[model samples]
Target: MAQHGWVTQTQNPARTADAWWRDAVIYQIYPRSFADADGDGVGDLPGITSRLRHVADLGVDAVWLSPFYTSPMADAGYDVADYRDVDPLFGTLADADALIAEAGRLGLRVIVDLVPNHTSDEHVWFREALAAGPGSPERARYLFRDGRGPDGSEPPNNWRSVFGGPGWTRVTEPDGRPGQWYLHLFDVKQPDLDWTNPQVRAEFLDVLRFWLDRGVAGFRVDVAHGLVKAEGLPDWAGEHGLLDGTVAPMWDQDGVHEIYRTWRQVLDEYPGERVLVAESWAPTPERLADYVRPDEMHTAFNFDFLETHWIAADLRESITRSLAATAAVGAPTTWVLSNHDVVRHPTRLALPQVGRRPNGIKATDPQPDEALGLRRGRAATLLMLALPGSAYLYQGEELGLPEHTTLPDEARQDPTFFRHNGEVAGRDGCRVPLPWAADEPAMGFNKTGATWLPQPESYRRYAVDRQRGVPGSTLEMYRAALRLRKELRLGRGDLSWVDDASDETVSFVTETPGGSVAVVTNLGREPVKAPAGEVLLSSGELEDGQVPTDVTVWVRQ
Candidate 1:
């Protein structure tokens, strides 16, 4: 490991299946809020490129950037208007290229988000479909069908959008009459692409090449389980719950595996072990493993682990099931706590009730116990990193930043907020611009332009400048943990449950250099007994040689 945890150029020169990603630590960067290099309040490629050093200092192996492609911002950048180009809001293509080069220079691999299931309404293909009218080749590229009613005024089916409201949006004909409807699993502005259309498949393949040619190490495939739908796009009665429900016809269809097999072949054609990660949601861990079979993707996000509450039994089950399923296919398991799309873990763990599924917190909502949430969050992270697989860190998470739970409704931008008729506040709370300088304007997220999302004043204490070298600070804890994790090769270690584990706590031992290290976590109120060992790193101070509540300790037994 070099200064930035980068391998020397001579290392892995053949670019074979080095499998670096198997145990890698990737940091997800939501560029809209990462940093603003220019005077613009919104973050751009230059902003991210400049601040990447901070990410490198955290000792992550790579950076996973959310969509920065041309978009209408209907669902942030998820409504991608053009996959081959960068959005002006983020910067130019040259800027993207420079960012990739800079990340490589820092020994950091870059992984860009790839939205293959859908395209923005403003995308040229969608625009062409709109102009070409129904029954045309252009219209064939998307899921366009006639309305169900006699007058063709109603939607084609009862399928609901993940963002609420109707999934099928009726489009007027070129002659200006109410015509056929297009399927949009998410926002109305994001129409689902018809994978059955050969041209559509060709276009996305080209998009992958364009970015890979630009020097991105790989892609985080958005809706990886959704490139294909059921035969007739049949009606589904249940509400969509990606992180917590049975698979739907419109999601995790078997046909998706065929697409990934092709994608895997394309990825293997390139050198440097270019990887593909699936952002998939399935009915079970076994089903999720299908997306990462050796012939398909390299890995899939372990959402079951992410959705599990801070319970010992649940966490152990999720981890065991995930590792077993992924191992069955010989693929690495990917662990993540928070991302731009979800509420921060600290806030999620601290909240008492589950009023909202994916919608973020609000000022009017019951506020979470911030200190308790953070304590548990740190404990959870230590336990996660100690597990045997790759891990992902959300931006600002290393600083122990909680979701902006008090963000006013007027400042909200996530489409979920508007789609739910303001009844449910959205993910904006977790996407606020990060606080880099406690004393600077907008916490040093930007120089002059107004932040796309307002930053909470409480972020001052969690600012990078405030915690840079402070002992016991969340940022420093993450740095130390990452350093130790790599030095001890903990990600590749064999894991086994400790005999003394109880219902309230998880106790496991993992093979290390000379012997094995024990990881013990206390989730319940009562302090639990821990195995006698020298403390290597602890999420919190050990109390009287016992593991305190919301604490996780790594000990050399």
Candidate 2:
């Protein structure tokens, strides 16, 4: 593959004068669950455009739409079948164009998901690869290798899927014999594309240009760290999980950076501050920083911060390290609390912090305390907003929604569930449809059809209609905080720790052009005296002059 030099000096004409993404609050919309128009039971592009008003009113700068590309819905939309067109289930290319125009009209930039690391087994290229048999150019576009056994029956290596089971699946060759195995770090339906192939590189670059020309503000690069594997399809010696940060041959290879450098050039061609946000899971903050260097990507998700336990000391340390790491590369860090993949942070924070970070907990597992979880979630949001740089808000999280932990087994849709044979419940709980109305059928998510995933009766209480403008509602808190975040210019500021805070609380000050804002969060059991400053906002009711446990307060100093 030809390597492109980093073009650091060229400025993109499409870049917004403000470079909106640099401290922007971007909302991640899981289209399938966000809103469904046309009574289709599934959310679509028009549905998202219809709800842009709500997002605009929330004061976010951009909206990152998860994959709506043509797919078999295997691994949901992550198993992309066609990068150039919208899935009928989503809508048409015209619908996406209308969406981009409508969002721009409403002052919200649009960023679409790009799954470059893999493609659906049903994708035209993958299907052709299978039909072309081993050693074909089509097969070379993906990771297909001869098995290690005498009859080539065994897999090439011992790698396992992040969803469980073997990562490689043997395919019957066109000649009718058991043949070369293909790699799928996730589901068997999603075969990892071989970045080593020039065709694959040219295809994605053109794909980026297609959307960029259609006026997408940017792309959220999925599995950005795993696009390039080590040479010779080496065997595994490290942990098999995707985001664990273990040193693995299949992840965060140096070659991936070269790919991003090429991608950066593609992004620089357009204006409007065209950006590339990475969903990378490199081992350390320092390693993660490499993805966002000036010549590489624009930003990478701070999973280190997201996966950290709900401990004040731990969170402070992670936040500190994240800021330092991004600073080293001159890039802003992006923070996210909950997304479609993980359990709602509200519920996750409420649970007892024990063992490895739990992605989701089944109803049979120890349940989180609702009150405690909501309280902590609100506090955490405030703490995140007070930091310097970008923040990605998952849909429905602003409503203080907790995970629907009791979904019936038959209703589960995540591939992880089926792959694990129901032992592990998977991520379907967090991807449930958003509630829009307290009294409307399907919570106003669908026109007259059932939601793709059942919404709990509990969701009615948290519906948008019920919470809108209600004083102290989670929705209202988020609205006010976002408005204040901009007025105080916190996003494009520098963060520094407040040295006098106790270990059980995390305190920091963001020095921005507007002013210095102090944020103090109490994660302990007792109230702590409010730091000396003018109190601006509190995630919960303050007790006298002190901040209560599981609460965060902002002050102007």
Task: Summarize candidate 2's per-residue lDDT along 1-557 as a digit string, tens digits.
Answer: 01122112112111222567778899999999999987778999999989999999999999999999999998889999899999999899999999999999999999999999999999999999999998899899999999997888899999989898899999988889888999999999999999989999999999999999999988999989899888987888777545565768988898999999999998998877899999988888989999998899998999989888888878977987787788777778789999988989998888877656565667788777988999999999999998888899999999999999888888888989888888888999899999999898799997694888999889999999999989999999999999999998788766666664367888776677788787889888888888677888999999898899999999888
lDDT per residue (tens digit) for residues 288-345 in model 1 = 9898888998878888888887878888788878877887777777899999888999
Please give the range of 10 consecutive residues that has the lowest summed lDDT in model 2.
1-10
RMSD of 2: 6.1
Q: So what's the TM-score on candidate 1?
A: 0.95
Task: Kindly report which residue stretches of model 2 are placed more than 4 angstroms away from their true locations once superposed.
Answer: 1-18, 241-245
Clash pairs (backbone) in predicted model 2:
13-271, 14-271, 14-272, 14-273, 15-271, 15-272, 15-273, 16-272, 16-273
Error of 1 at 393 (Å): 0.5
Candidate 2: Cα lDDT at 97: 96
Poorly placed runs, candidate 1 (over 4 Å)? 1-18, 241-245, 353-358, 513-515
lDDT of candidate model 2 versus the reference: 0.87
Reference-based TM-score of each model: 0.95, 0.96
